[model samples]
Target: MKKFTYENITHAKELNIYLEQGNRVLGALGYTDHSGKHTAKVAMTAGKLLKKLGYDDHTVELARIAGYMHDLGNSINRASHAQTGALMAFQFLRSWGAPLEDIAIIISAIGQHDESNGTAVDPVSAALILADKSDVRRSRVRNTVPETFDKHDRVNYAALSSTLHVDVQKRIITLEVELDEGICFLMDYFEIFLQRLLMYKRAAEVLGLRFKMKANGSKIS
Candidate 1:
């Protein structure tokens, strides 16, 4: 059998439709952008994180695939999307004749990415959690009108810039964010992201690293 790669998944027309439809569904619900751009970023970040931690090339690639397909469940609905996406990815990868071992890892990561009922089950899953939660920026906000901004929208819009730094030697994964205070206070960020921050902490723990966050140049977690 041919070796399946992340490129295969990224270019697959069937998978792309699910990703596109998921973003559209989220947009209709006033959520931040969950489009291809976000998935691509998550994929890159997940791969980088695993690579920095000294994982093998195959494992790193699997992480990238998991990150890219993690949110496809949103195509059906936001609630339980993690579990839904995992099932969808399982069937999709199986159809492509991907190895059962690889499919297991990818599906596990996808199944546990949600904060509601998710934990860091493995390196790939932990990396996916960190990558997904750390994606916050003004560009993610689709609604231009301030009046229509909910807590999620305001917090995301206030994030002028965001970067995730992984230091293998120090064993630290830090999320540095430049938030625009004029749009929303730092407290608002916590109000909306406290669960995600807690999830990040656990995810970092699973990777044997420390999770830290700095918003507006001050460490918040």
Candidate 2:
């Protein structure tokens, strides 16, 4: 078993600052789950899923890195933040002496992470899509106090819990959300997330798997 390590010094400290600053900015804008914990979870999940699918270590690491830094563009603005994030990541990685090809992959992945602004340009993009979409849940909003809970947050907050499981042998990727109907119903949740879920299905197709969503013990898809 080989461990992955990058020679970049800035990744250790500067990435921390980016994550912190992103959290502060999103908190101000009433968005939840753009913080360290969220990004870390996404990174780990993306890497593990790719690794389980038998991708090379470099690919998995790229997926992890892309997942971690995907939301940094939100620091500047919500719209087209993915493109801004890609440029930011490209400059930082280049400064730290990361290879240009790898930097390109990372930047492309970051730039296309948003469903509205993104497309699956590579396997990394597919992995990132799975990781990002799997993060919808109630616990994500447990700490942040939004001024007005919109459909996005309300459906997410209504989830009592959620789990994303990738079954390698079965070629199955399941997103299960335990819901509390007092806050929002399944319809409301689907109304907000259905499109993203479709994107997740396409992402899963790229990974040769099925994307299944189970809400309150019922299979919705």
Top candidate, metric TM-score: 1
Model 1 residue 120 lDDT score: 91
Clashes by residue pair, model 2: none
* Backbone collision tally, model 2: 0
35-58 per-residue lDDT for model 1 (tens digits) = 999999999999998998999999
Candidate 1: segments with Cα more than 4 A from true spot: none
**Residue-wise C-alpha lDDT for candidate 2, range 91-191, written one tens digit per residue:** 77777677788888889989888888566667898888888877877767744554578877888888777777788889998888888898888889888
Q: Any idea how many clashes model 1 has?
A: 0
